[model samples]
Target: MRTQTLLTAMLIGMATPAALAGPAADFRAADANGNRQLEFDEFRVFVDLRANGGNAQAKKVRLFKAYRLALGKVDYDGDGIVTGDELIRFDRANGKS
Candidate 1:
């Protein structure tokens, strides 16, 4: 999957999503390998796209910080990978499921 699309997928319940698709859509697009795990580098791109500011560089910085902050919460295994089951659990916990 493209980096941006994957990044966007990892963000399951953001109030202001940069991508038009919802969490399920993003997840599906990212999990192309059928392993049901979304490896995020593109997820970073998705977060970067959500960063607001006039400077592109500033947005990138924000994206990295934000992504790091969020990674742990979603990556339950600490493996730096988010599986479909993980997303579902997260969404349910957040009442977004």
Candidate 2:
């Protein structure tokens, strides 16, 4: 019984992040002008995700830089723009689905 309970708890813990990740990504994508791709200005979403009840303002600049790199990498085409199709392709290629 204890082993079963432990296994269930482990499974739930592992699943939680994956479940939460989608919603967060959706939220960020929406705020990114409905493009489903993130831009530098959209860094706010990621910043909000990483910020806690502490030092949010302090972390702003660093988060912006990190978000820039992250967004750049995901843009993939280097066209200075990202489309919904591109995002979907990226997600699939990265095994998001």
Candidate 3:
């Protein structure tokens, strides 16, 4: 049973990075200006576009807070920008990889 549990944990850890690859690709594509970083407006648009058709206006305040929190996590350097490398580091820190 212990061996099986260890194997399962290993598998999950390995798959985490692969699962995040799609989001990384989406981030790259969402970088319209190709500045290699996501600014507030760009990140906002990306979040809205990926919002699954939800009525953003209905939850404007809540959504804004959530967006800010997400961006804060990725903007590790606190420079008001999110780069791909920062995103990867964020994911790792958040246990997504």
Better of 2 and 3 by lDDT: 3
lDDT of 1 at 28: 53
Looking at model 2, residue 72 earns an lDDT score of 50
- Which pairs of residues collide in model 3? none
lDDT of 3: 0.53
lDDT of 1: 0.52
| TM-score per candidate, chains pooled | 0.50, 0.41, 0.58
As a whole number from 0 to 100, the lDDT of residue 34 in candidate 1 is: 56
Best by lDDT: 3
Provide the clashing-pair count of each candidate structure.
3, 0, 0
The TM-score that candidate 2 achieves is 0.41
CA lDDT, every prediction? 0.52, 0.43, 0.53
> What is the clash tally of candidate 2?
0
Pairwise TM-score winner, candidates 2 and 3? 3
Candidate 1 C-alpha lDDT tens digits along 1-97: 4554444444544422222355445545545565656677645543344443232432544555656645556677889876656656655666564
